[model samples]
Target: MAHLSLSWANVAIVLSLCLGSISYGYDFSIISTTVGQPTWYAYMGLTTDPTQASLYSYSNSIIGTIFGLFSAGAIFGGLFVGWFSDAHGRKKSLLSAAVINIVGGALQAGSVHVGMFIVARFITGFAAAMLVALVPVYIAEVAPPAIRGLLVGQHGAFFLVGYTVAAWVAVGSFYSANASFNWRFPLSLQALWPLLLCFFVYWLPESPRWLVSKGRPDEAWKILAKLHYDPKDPEQLFAREEFFQITSQCAADKASYGDVSLLHLFTKPHLRKRTLVATLVMWASPANGAIVIYSNIVVLVAGLGFDSADSLLLSAGWITLACVGNFANAFYLDKLGRVRSMVIGYVGCIVFVIIEAAIVAEYGGTTNKAALSAGVAMLFGFITFYGGFVDTTIYVYCSEIFPTHVRAKGMGWSIAVFFLGNLPFLESSTTGYATIGWKYYLLFIILPALNVGLLIYFCPETKGLSLEEINGIFEDKVAVRLTNLTEEERRDLDSRILDGVVGKDPQAQAPERNNVEKSAEVTLDE
Candidate 1:
């Protein structure tokens, strides 16, 4: 057997997977501009007073309700995406999301009424949910084990880039004299990204693991040859040991396509813990009130006394800062243990939220420009900490928590719960702000504290470990001791596990199965 290096073909496959993240990011941020247009309010016949003749008035409650509904749709979409991706494959699921994006974007851009617009937003939100749920899974599967953290971290970086682009686009559209139709252009333009993804994804290969699971060893070998080894090498000779190990593991766990049922997620031992860890990590991801703030920073800024134009500019700036922060996170994720990075981020967010709360309490919507600027600064601080750490870690953590058999489903469940936590805040933003005033920052502060506590107790370190090693961590007895392994041992383990090559020695197989069962029992007990 000949040794194969992780080659350019592998890098190309990873890049192609990363594009799905870009699509997810682009779709998520495009709405910020469109929702703020004057025509949107005018079409709804909005007024300051709810008692007036307007359909929805410029009431915070109405806006919050709209945002909340979108979140709800996303929760449903996330839930649905898991089954879809499992049944249809990641590429096909992504293509489905792209189609939804096109339809939703078109409807939203050309909407003639508030009802139509809200419904369109829901449709778009559903598509965004699918993207969020599946993109990380795709990236994780395709990435080289050595760079999985970095590549998975790139999802957040790309998401912030999408957000930054939307911010600038919003600013430009608002500044244009023909702002009415220009806002529509930003929303409409999102359609192009998904269309591009749909075209390009067809050129990419199916997940090699997925092929192995389905017993198509020849196809899986061909893919591995193209992706990691030289195709001209003797068939099954290069990486034969590694490939045999991987295939053996897959054969041990083999099940038909029909056996990939959601019930298995709960009933199967290996899968149950995976589902729990994925859920917790995802629940922690957006639970810090970051998504609420991201979606409604315009309003939050107005509460700080900035005029609409300045608020938009400030929002744009914050998002740009966040994009930079996300890039920094991508650079550091592998060096910083996932658990540590996430903890540090949550701690920082807690401090910033407290400061922001104080600023809001001191100013109390007082129209004092200095006070408002201070509030904006604090908010920007919050964004910086969030994007740099929490945002990036969530996707990486989710990607690492599950084994190949249930990775997509685990991710989908996590995203669905994330959206569920997000929905209430998105809907009640106006009520939360109006009733609590500047004290609304309390909500953000509280969640991160809870998040930090959860991490301390539940989350585990995943730095410098192979997928199989990480999988072993959920078991009570495996000890998760990667620090003891030599570099060669680590590489060999990763290659063997990923290529489905595990020895049939009872000593090895017994411990692994015992670990899987123990992990499942622990998760159920939790």
Candidate 2:
């Protein structure tokens, strides 16, 4: 193994994981276009009158229910992936997700009945669930602590980019007028993305930390050498040390292959706090009503009296703005601590949503274009704030909050809550839109306020911590002294600390003794 900068390898992993996000984005956005199509209702055998439309729109709920179900599958998949990656490796789990993607995409695109489509979407959702749950874990695992935020943040950034592309495609397909082929083309195209990803993923290396955990010290060193550390240098010594820290934490927590019981998540103190934070973050992101608003933008705008083309364009513009916000977030997330970003975002969402509700209440059913424009602008503002902060930060925060042992399970469980929140809107846009009317925006307002409280109360700062140090935060054992270290010092401590936990080999006892001595000294001093 020769010393290589793992930076390139990390980028490779990001690119591969992004394929799954593309599928997620595509599925979510495709519905917006499909909902607008006359043919879609015809195929589903439904009418489009506002009252009748509510029934037709119940299909959205059906889709959402399936989405939630698949998310349930994903919770399992994510939990399994954690142990599987620890046992079989990250690359293999990714390969497994790709296979699910291919099959699910095929079934969805070719469906002749709603049942088949539902089943296909459910499977695809499961695949997406796993991708969302695992990809961040993979990126966090492979990244240098210096750039972990930037790398993990890229997942959300790219996810928004994927959403932008989906919006563009939706708008194009809406205008294409090839009634026979319009929506299907965009849905089917998503299938090719995961297939292409499979080819590229082969070039990427396995996670170096994972290699060490599996007791392959030489192979781990080889990977570390390629990641820009000298094979024979003491850094490999340091790398081994960091690996043990994670393993020891897993053991102390009783985390193991097949140990990912959902009951354990609630019963274990350390795991429970992690689960709480992750679930709240994930729940907060979708509960703001952004997904509902975006998914049904056409109907929302139409209800406000905008023309169909104009509504689609507005949706496109909002998505474009969201992309910009996502980009800005990716660049600055490391600078802004996760809790701060989320708090600011929730505040912004509350204000904007209230304003949108006000505008709609004042003139939603009127013929005044200016009143309608104000409503639209308010909607855009809500999306802008959402994209800027909550959208991007949620994933980064969720992944960072959990220990590596149950990271996947934690993420999966939280995301399942997110999709479960999605289930209501699918049944009837009216469920939210009619029940609240323009006041529907108010529902979003209240949730973010709750999120703001949760973030301030429960969430901890995680701006510059290494993965191991992050675990220490959850355990409440990350010392204040450790927090004062320079970035370089922190990295060195993380590497040295972890090596002591996992040891150089299973039979090696020297590093474990060293860790015990160091831990005692640190504890006594504190």
Candidate 3:
């Protein structure tokens, strides 16, 4: 839709859907914090002082195992959800995740042993992974192309809202007189978000694209118009055009590939390339090396020579700042376009990481206050830029890259790889900071440097185009991207397709369509 204004109804829909993200975020922050509680250590027969968690060998084993198990669970969860979301439908998949998380959260809160708690963590990871991977697909399907970035980017911002809240609440529990309350109370809070989602999820609209794929075009048309309705444009021309685009493209997609199968993601030449780009981009999203900082922010803050009392407060504030940065990203993202925003993120990551390595290498062991201060500022800068540019853009970019038929499966694989991308940086120990020092930062620079090259040649601009329009770009069905064209140009292109598309049998055009189309790779320059 050209020059569309966001309706209040659409904004409400976006906000309501973000509860799943908030749950995913809260679970993420709560896990990292609850693992550090004194009672948690006691339960595991380890040191009460979490600061010594690393110093103690058994504590290191369990803590590392916990993180590893969570990653494993998340990977499997991603693979499962792709098939589930596509087969059942988007809203059902979301609700299933919420229900699963409710069970996982309760398991986590009331665990009687370390094994149960470990199981609980795995379950929570499974459900949380589904939530994150699926939310963007549903939102992208329904969001107006004009503000698609701004709408879909809310997943990043809202999850961080949960992250920020979990941070402050963990701080509150840390100071509580009751020891078990420190871990149990915060872990129990995980149930709250999914419970909220379960209560309100019925209000959400199903993805119109999914409906069309299911042979429900009349329903899809009504929902699409409602989603993109502009009161000023009473005729809803954009909405009608958008519905036409999705249905026709999906018709062609069905003709090209008989049914949705995981094998198609690997076997189809065009799909294989998309899957590769999505996977690499997802990998690149976490390769920026901010995981080291996020997992150790309180320690990093404390190391800046601040009093212990203020470290947690400052950590919470930093996450909140990152949350704000995500909101800023939501707004600026469409204006910059997905590929450029990601490149800016990669280039910025390389720049700040280099500066950070230099600062730490120069004065890491020294009590030189100015140098310490500069190093701390650089860490904050790196995270803020990464959160705004890279972290926030991953979902928006990946969700739009595939056609409606395979988007869920594509995202599942992408998010699964995303979990793997994070593994290399989970060093979670200051041993690297102290033993390897600045050289550890140097390790992170390589992938993002490689990523900028991958992005320039592999990723294309998807901003300001409908989801079906983007599929056309990948298939080489259009010579010029509609996003870069004038209204007249789009009208001309639409008129040709509209003749065969509007109120006609899609199969009738299949033979002629097959003769002209090519499944070539698309790039920024192409």
Q: Which candidate wins on lDDT?
A: 3
Instruction: Give per-residue lDDT, candidate 3, residue 198.
Output: 82
lDDT of 3 by residue, 1-526 (tens): 4457577768887888899999988887776666545567777676524367564655555665666566677888899999999999988998999998989889988988878887888898899889999989988988878889999999988998988988889889889889788889888989999888887789877888888777677677767667777878754556656666676676667666657687889998888888988988888876777655676676566656554446677778778888898888888998988888888877877888898789877887688889877877787788778887877798899998988889999999888898777655653444455456678777779978987898899887888887877876577343223456687987776665456444343334434333422221122114
lDDT of each: 0.71, 0.68, 0.77
Please state every model's RMSD to the true fold in angstroms.
Answer: 6.0, 5.4, 5.3
Off by over 4 Å in 3: 2-5, 48-55, 302-308, 359-370, 427-438, 476-526
lDDT measured at residue 495 in model 2 versus the true structure, 0 to 100: 56
Whichever of 2 and 3 has more lDDT, that candidate is: 3
Candidate 1, overall lDDT? 0.71
- Candidate 2 lDDT over 52-127, as tens digits, reads 7667467545544544455455545555555555567778877777778778778867878777777777777777
Q: What is the lDDT of candidate 3?
A: 0.77
Could you tell me the lDDT of residue 39 within candidate 3?
68
TM-score of each model, in listed order: 0.86, 0.84, 0.88
Give candidate 2 misplaced runs (Cα > 4 Å): 1-6, 51-87, 229-260, 476-526
> Candidate 1: where are CA atoms >4 Å away?
1-6, 47-58, 230-242, 255-260, 476-526
Q: Find the 10 residues in a row with the least total lDDT in model 1.
A: 501-510
lDDT for residue 219 in candidate 1, whole number 0-100? 62
Residue 246 C-alpha lDDT in model 1: 45
